[model samples]
Target chain A: MKKISILALACMLAACAHYSLAPEGAHTVQGMSFVSTTDWNKSSLRSGAKSEVWTKDGERLNQLTFIGGIKDGQTIFTSRSKELPMPEFRANMLPNELMELVVTSLKNSSGGELVIDATNLRPQRLQGSIGFRFDMSYYDSNGLARRADCIMVKKDDRLNLIIFSAAGMHYYPKEAAEVDSIFSSLQL
Target chain B: MRLLLSLLLLFASLASVAEGAQRFEPTLPPGYAPDKSTDEGGLWYQVERFEEQLQTSPHIIRNTALTEYLEELVCQLAGDYCGSIRVYLVKNPHFNASMYPNGMMHVHTGLLLRVANADELGAVLGHELAHYLRSHSIDQWRNAKKSLGIAAFIDIGLAALHEDLHGLARDVATVGLMRYNREQESEADAYGVQIIATHGYDPAASVSLWKYIEAERGADKSKDTSSIFFATHPKVENRIARLKQHIKRYGKNPKTDETDLDEFQNLVVAEYEGLMDEQIALQEYEQTAEMIDRHAAIGYPDSLIKFYRAELHRQRKKFGDERAAIDLYRKAATFERTAARSHRELGYLYIKHGLNDAAKDAFESYLEITPNADDREMINFYLETLR
Candidate 1:
């Protein structure tokens, strides 16, 4: 009975943490929403390096654009592919304005209550800025657990946005610093 | 002897003070100080500070060419009454136009699309003018912060007015005389009808202008701004109705001159339309979300009503959502549609999920329709590889 209960608990947890198995970078929405942090950082969004980036078993629906936003070139992904949710890219909108949207999105949202401590991992303004790394644990419907650190970089205006996210439990701890350095070093 | 001379002096001063206030131009130049008895200088200062901060903010688009063009147009329409007040043509998709304590007005491009013509635009501008001239926001700012240190209060108040106003809208409605300043808006409305009529544009155009805005609200992608605008300025229906009532009572001779809609449309014709397309297309997720909101706000049409349930389920990724969106795509593709690209999307998803056969079918269906498809090469290659 105990064993059955444990199994049942695991199942329920899995159900609550249900993530789309579509594949990383497989589904490609045309435009990508990037630069996810405001100067305000009300949600502990930009915190120290030790901060959690993403919870284990948590699915982040994200897109990687090579150059311009969703309208521009190719996207980079891991083994799985998922379409990014394309967003408005006004011709009159400057980079700074879009960046503001990225940061203040939660502040503006009515139910935006999530706050994570991700200091150095915050998105910087400079091009070829370092890739970010952090461990995050999100609450699932059934109370399951997961962690991950997603590495993101702005490559160039033409074909530049490249992102690499992985299970934060192992990969974020081992290779995040190296990934950041690699992103920082990237000229193109 | 002293009391008699003092009494005579007080009356003379009162007479002159009233005369000077009348002479005071509601539209003051950048640095003009209002004579102490008249007190318009304070508003000018507050406006200056707001303008300075607005320049650096993301909303401010410093396009000299566009500003010059707009300035020329406004001058042509209301050259005499046109104050030193300038406008910033912002690039947001939400429809709103506002003026600050000084003479700076920010007009979102979204507002330009909704207005029918130059005359309608003038009404909005005239309303903004009334706010500045009457010193509504400034007086509101002053009355709300009367308890605090005047300098510190103004500093925080100006930032709060220009920067944190939206944030405060949820919390502070009654501050700085910002609370229920409808009297000022009425004054602006009255001023505008006369100005528009004086300028040889039809004074009655204001009624048509608002009716069109209300109609377009139903068509707007995000009705958030409209809902919020009406909520704060409640019973705008009454406002428009009242204006019509005014026109009836004092109905001036109808002008034969036509308001220039052609020149107005020409300013943003092809480019604005393209931006609108991107606004709708890029916000596809929001567009899908909008359907549910539509049902709640009003009743849904039969065709789209069904998708409301299915789309929510799909977003949650239950009951084979990929299949559902594909089904939706198939149904949608049959009609005269804007999202023809959806067919290609269905194909790509099928292949990515290791369903090559399903993908092949999707690609074939897409190829049948898209003659000059941008993704033709990729689709053809995927199909060839499957073979």
Candidate 2:
């Protein structure tokens, strides 16, 4: 049961368009540019026009997601069905509301199995715009405990965000410093 | 002789009509084990592996006392089949209790939060047990296999069995494969009522549970029916009417029947706040508001209800909501149990409104109440900034 059939794996692969190598140093993706101190593999399965994801080992191990220039009424994640109640971004949202939006969006995206605990909300600057930062800890689908650091800013009535998540037991502590450095180098 | 045999068959058919169809009996024997060569056995193998994963899942509430309570309650309802069942109380904020063919049962926290009494909880659990006893999931699986061929069936099974797959994929596969037919649902509903009434629980509790759910569903502006339980089950109004009919047939003795509200509340109080937090996180304001009010009507502490009400207001942040939240939080802070969290929220609101002195006071009160709070450093930073 642990091993998914090759056909099922192929079906999953078909859903993804492709992957590209995100080499070390400065790179522009979507609407923002950032400098990566290390090489990473980027998924071509963008959720929207302004969102992209990069991974070091695999998506389950560690992932860095960039969502940029999401307009008001646009959801943080792309939902397939109109019935799904994905939270929309609003320009007038307060700092705490933004955190809630992310939490709700993630919960909905995961189909409510994930138990997320978000804490340590504080203000930070992201590419010269005042933004908020928070930490979240939750278990993934495979019951692996994971942690994420998220930073979001509102610029020109649109939302910009970066989230780096990794397994709490090992990968998070191993890659946290590099992730922080990369986040620091983000320019919008 | 042939004429006599035909008359006897006709009489049997007439008797069945008089009884309004034969009642569904449990097909599963106690401690039943299917042979490995059979398709049912293959399904069991898949489920047993999923159970292994579930055992390690973070979502499983590990509270020994709560788990024991639920197990005992299920044992009471299950009777001879008790030994075959294993109950898992999952920390999910959705109203659901699901039963697997292999006798693994999951009771979600949201259901616990919503149920008014142990009898209501028993009603829901009994319904799930009825499904298990009737082997509804297996029947549905076999039906799907007959219609779709073996290859497609295995694909559906593997999609549900794969741990690496996203929840949406798994849910779609599971819902499509395990959805019981209308007749099976009615059978289970009838059995659920019969079992609870036999156990001396108020059969009307089943009707009450459905009515509450129907109202809660109506309260939601978005009418989001994404919950697996809501999606896979029959319509709530229909369920309510049918349950009422069953209750009427089963009869009720109000003075003698047990609700066990006190015991249910006592056992679940420890997990209440966390459960409410998860519910609030769904961001379904009107529905959550209705739930909070219903919980209040059940006699949960006013302070706790007020705090959650304030939290809903704070999170929703509609026009003039912050003021309403401030008022509620201020009221809640008068109670010792909720004082610390209320102060913390008040601090955040005060800071947001640029009332620096009030923010400092509220934060200090929060720190004093919860000296070792996890966010102490962050609170201290805010205090320094205010100075």
Candidate 3:
């Protein structure tokens, strides 16, 4: 647990809406830009409505979509040592679906009650891909349940995101819809 | 008027308890309290605060109908068998069961959701009861008085149970109540065996019960099993080994009908699949590691390993890993079709990757499926953003 000064907390909140142009800075990937809503994919798969997906080179490769995102400097990211090291397993797969499958399975598996309140979404970042967030229900049966709210940035056609799934009973209270608003409306 | 005013004042004081030296806070908002008012832990003021908070929630354990069934089993067993005692169903999923100084026992929902059978469940309940007869929570509190373990009792995690006490460093409360002391646990297990036998519940079920827990531990890759069980108890292998060796003492025990246990089964059946998967979602690296180890050790179903692998991918922040987790979540959701949360995560995945329409649809889909969701504000917020 790191000591977050009031200043640091303020910085994070302030940065929530602030996005730099492509090639942002050190913590950001090079040549990254926010995809326009027009290039996004509108899928009817989402509860009979369209979902927008922004991807690299105008393709679904490493796309950034939303519900909401969950963010935490310390907790969201898992150990990547194994994933990077296990290149042999990923040898034949396309990089995009490969990553999407991993994140998707991670969120989908934890079991809990499927709750979709109009406001149950949470936002989180995808990994080193770029800057993206993901959403899922709090702990559901694979766990309790958290609604998913995810965000990400597309850079060099890659995706980076912060993801969250908490015991809806415990985790959701700390960050949920507030995070969703922070994510979807984020200009960066 | 005099008595009424006094009561009103007392209620007001209890309701407004601040974080205190005596009062313990369960992580998150909701908390719990033991039925017996008198706590042997020398922290009666904390207990007083706990009593105050317990008023609103009453008992935090869910699936009330099932909990009542479990309580009845314990009470009935307590009446007939020598060591059977009262059980308080708890809502938490952390693996713990306790016996207070008084005869009352508090069992976390984690135990209820995990235990396989009524007999095994009885075994855990019986073990806690043994602590009451043995009087463990008080004795340990007295022995370690003024220790940092007690001092670090900040309100975090579970409101009733301190998550701080969960780590090896925080051995504040001895493994819930009975599971705390080895000698006590052993004594309880032995007595529980005898009690189960008398009640016509298979005594062998006790050994198998713990084996299931250990097996679950083995299957989890991220958990540090040593701390979950070993760190708290010194001679870890021996304790489990002893239970194995001791249960055999009553040779060739006849099996009890699991049929009569159906109502009991029906009671907890709802939470079983949900609990297992729910815990999967609460997957801490240590917890996953621990579950993997326990399951492998006891030879239970190794299916959870796939989840561990998926979680491993989740922890890794690369696009590849996130994609992998999403797919696994999909499979898990499919296998667990009723899992609205799983579907919601899919919805969330769509949202995070610049897929607003997808996010909206996923969120909307999620609401349609779940009976109740606490994230109404969050879901609504997303909907508004999309609009």
Task: Indicate the docking level reached by candidate 3.
Answer: incorrect
Top-TM-score candidate index: 2
Q: Answer with 1 or 3, whichever has the higher TM-score.
A: 3
- Candidate 2, residues B1-387: lDDT per residue as tens digits? 999999998995575344333455789899988898999999899888878877777878875776888899899999999999999887777777777889988788889878888888989999989999989888988888888888987876677677542352346346466677776777788888888888888889888888888888889757657655676677888778767767777688464533455777767676678888888877778888888888898888888899999999988878998999999999999999899999999998998788999999999999999988866766777898799
Candidate 1 chain A minimal-lDDT segment of 10 residues: A38-47
Q: What does candidate 3's lDDT look like per residue over A79-139, in tens digits?
A: 3333112111122222233334334334332211122222322333333432323344322
Candidate 1 residue-wise lDDT at B225? 48
lDDT of each: 0.47, 0.81, 0.47
lDDT of 1 by residue, B282-377 (tens): 233443344335333433232343333333333334347666766765564454332344456566556646778987887787777775664465
Return whichever of 1 and 2 wins on TM-score: 2
Instruction: Give per-model TM-scores.
Output: 0.49, 0.87, 0.50
**Tens-digit lDDT track of model 1 for A31-92:** 23233211111121211221212222233321111222322322221112112222222322
TM-score chain B for all models.
Answer: 0.59, 0.90, 0.60
True contacts kept of each: 0.00, 0.36, 0.14
In model 2, what is the error at residue B6, expressed in angstroms? 26
Q: Candidate 1 overall Cα lDDT vs. reference?
A: 0.47
Q: Arrange candidates by TM-score, highest first: which order?
A: 2, 3, 1
